[model samples]
Target: MTSTLTRLPRPYQSYVYAYPHKTAYRPLAPRPTLHEVWAGEPRDPLSLYLHIPFCEIRCGFCNLFTRVGAPGDLTTRYLDALTRQAETVRACLGTEHSPRFANAAFGGGTPTFLEAGELIRLCDIAERVMGADLDAIGFSVETSPATATTDRLAVLAGRGATRISLGVQSFDENESRAAVRPQRRADVETALARIRDTAVDVLNIDLIYGIDGQTPASWRYSLDAALAWQPEEIYLYPLYVRPLTGLSRRDRAAADLAWDEQRLRLYREGRDHLLTQGYEQQSMRMFRRIDAPAPGPDDYSCQTDGMIGLGCGARSYTRNLHYSFDYAVSAQEVRAIIDSYTATTDFDRAVVGRAIDADEARRRHLLQSILQADGLPVADYRARFGTEPHTDFPVELARLAERGWLADTGPARLRLSPEGLAYSDAIGPEFFSTAVRAAMAEYELR
Candidate 1:
């Protein structure tokens, strides 16, 4: 049952993380009640996500569901709404279920964009409304080098944030400018110093390749500069210019074959460089220092556990459904959605989402697990599905193997070869069900 379709094009799509883009999600009419969504779902060891959708400035390549800067008291109003949403979610989970969050993350345009006092309140909401101890779990928060001020870093570190990921897309001034992310190298270095002064358990620096006019030498310089701090983790991302993003209006030649070839060369170069630096490749994008402290519960898996998302842009996942408030990439649409979210009182169930049937679930399980460098565990897949992954995704698996993207490394594992991992973006999309792709295609990109 191998796929008869043509292999997807190269320099390959980038699979930073996750699958089934939010565009694939449609409005759920007669949305299920939260309790109904969680019915018979395991309550222990869940993941919690708190989204702060405000940033000081929106980068050119950014298309995440976040807005640039807080308008007036919008920040205050947004936090209030988040609190209300958390309360509703917790109530729905119920006291009897005794939901224990195993891991938590604060992400957005930049969680550190909030003032020091605001950040304290954000942590309080997680503690009081959600019953998640900020200090007890593996808490990770996203920050920008410009926003990682000492006061903010102190607040995060004090609140039990184990990992702080700073988005330093590139250290080269021209590359940064080309990506429309302006900052002085001195500021980034100062922020790095301030972060280290906080003595946080893990420091993750994010770097982006494929910026317009970026070269191999420039990419190495950025990588080397990041390594100077001995960050616990590093994520190298390929820039994708999506619709409605700042970078979208750029010259058409930005995404040509020659540009892609340059990106691929830089990616491989950065990857090999990081490996030599004693960092382990967790995925194509994530590389962690060998000595970095292990974060998160080993038993918790996104496939099996539930997640609670507390902001308009945040998304919650249950066994059968993935949901969130309305999603938008355009600024006006994003503001409208945020305004609507702030005005809403009914926080009990999903509004915008796509229901996942058994087949979609299997596909998700495989797509999420197989993209990692370590690959998918056959025994675990069998234990959950009562059949081998090969049986469920025969066409997909066979095609990958035929193209040298997959290798059966052992009786208990089906892993992607390095080449296959390089093609993760292409491979991941191949597993998308026809219905999902069509739904996504039909979606209006507001």
Candidate 2:
């Protein structure tokens, strides 16, 4: 069946109504037990994702599971549980297997927003559970530009953080004020200079292209400032106005907001500019130094099967199952994440049935696989699944090819064209849509 969406911007119009946004959800196909896949198995590599949900303040555009002024004692309570959770995660490893860690990311409303003591304690928990060979691990932490302080950077280095992804949405004063993100350009530069001199191996700046009261000029300026810092990595994201947030509050009247055409153009410019500066396009949003290279495709998060999540709203994908816990929110929001994660089960099956569905698994592979520095290996897929992408996704691949959105450069190699990368969210329907995925898709497109 041939169909197209009729919006405008020609390419977008073709995707206007091709298919209903929602795709059928296929529950996870049966897989081996967690013990078998992760315990002592020689499966995929491993990483750790720790979530810290407290922030000194909130951003207008942020919808992450975080809160400001969450009880003064919140950090203490969270660290206690975090320690226990780390132990629980460590217990999952078989006695015979060696601890293998490729990366560890401390992400949140602002992980640096935590008190120095709490930050130190949490890092202790990581070292205790995973050990101190972190010198070999690609450890990363996220922070808002405003919160980047000398003390905070010092704490991160103490905890073995090798990279910092600072959030600097825009350089324009008006745009920063509109988004309620208060950080001067000078502050970010000073902070970066200090961080660069630290033990941290990589410096990553996160820039948002589309936002209320932001224009191409503003975005270009932000890009220029980020480039001036000469970070080892740069992540470019477009502004997304999600429902029920401060962003949605002013999204309607924001003429500076770059939607379809403008958003696309801004992204292209970022790519062109970064490429000119000797940064290779590692993925849609990420650019890295040519010689040093990134670990894999999904550098933001680990692509491996064993990711241990700590803190409220943290998500862990073990070999066979997934588990998550959130810090105490109002009775309402807690129930929401819990409900969504534990949907399939009556009481907590949704969360308990955490194994990823085949479709989602497939989609994850596509996104992360293409982004791989080593590139996707066709033989590797066949060895694992006993089938090829062409055999498994014949229809989907055919559709994408028909639209000239993708090209099969080799048996296992597929690349998204500029148009496809710009509209990459369309690839998600082939899998499931949790509230998070829906939110991510809507935000990425916006």
Tell me the whole-model lDDT of each prediction, alpha carbons only: 0.86, 0.61
lDDT of 2 by residue, 328-393 (tens): 333356445433432322111113224455554555565556434344567756665677777877
Worst 10 residues of 2 by lDDT: 16-25
Task: TM-score each candidate.
Answer: 0.96, 0.79
Q: Alpha-carbon error at 435 in model 1, in Å?
A: 0.7
Q: Candidate 2, TM-score vs. the true structure?
A: 0.79
Compared with the true structure, what per-residue lDDT tens digits does model 1 show for residues 1-446?
Answer: 43222234654554535546788888888988898888787888899999999888889999888888887899899899898898988888987778999999999979999999999999999998899987778599999987899889889999998998889999999889988899999999999999999888999999999898888888999999999999999998888887898899987664376666667788899999999999998887889999988876787897677788899988888888899888889999998998998888889888888887888888888988888888888888998889889888888889898888876697689888887876777788889889988987898999
Each candidate's number of clashing pairs is 0, 14
Candidate 2's C-alpha lDDT? 0.61
Q: Pull out the clashing pairs in model 1.
A: none
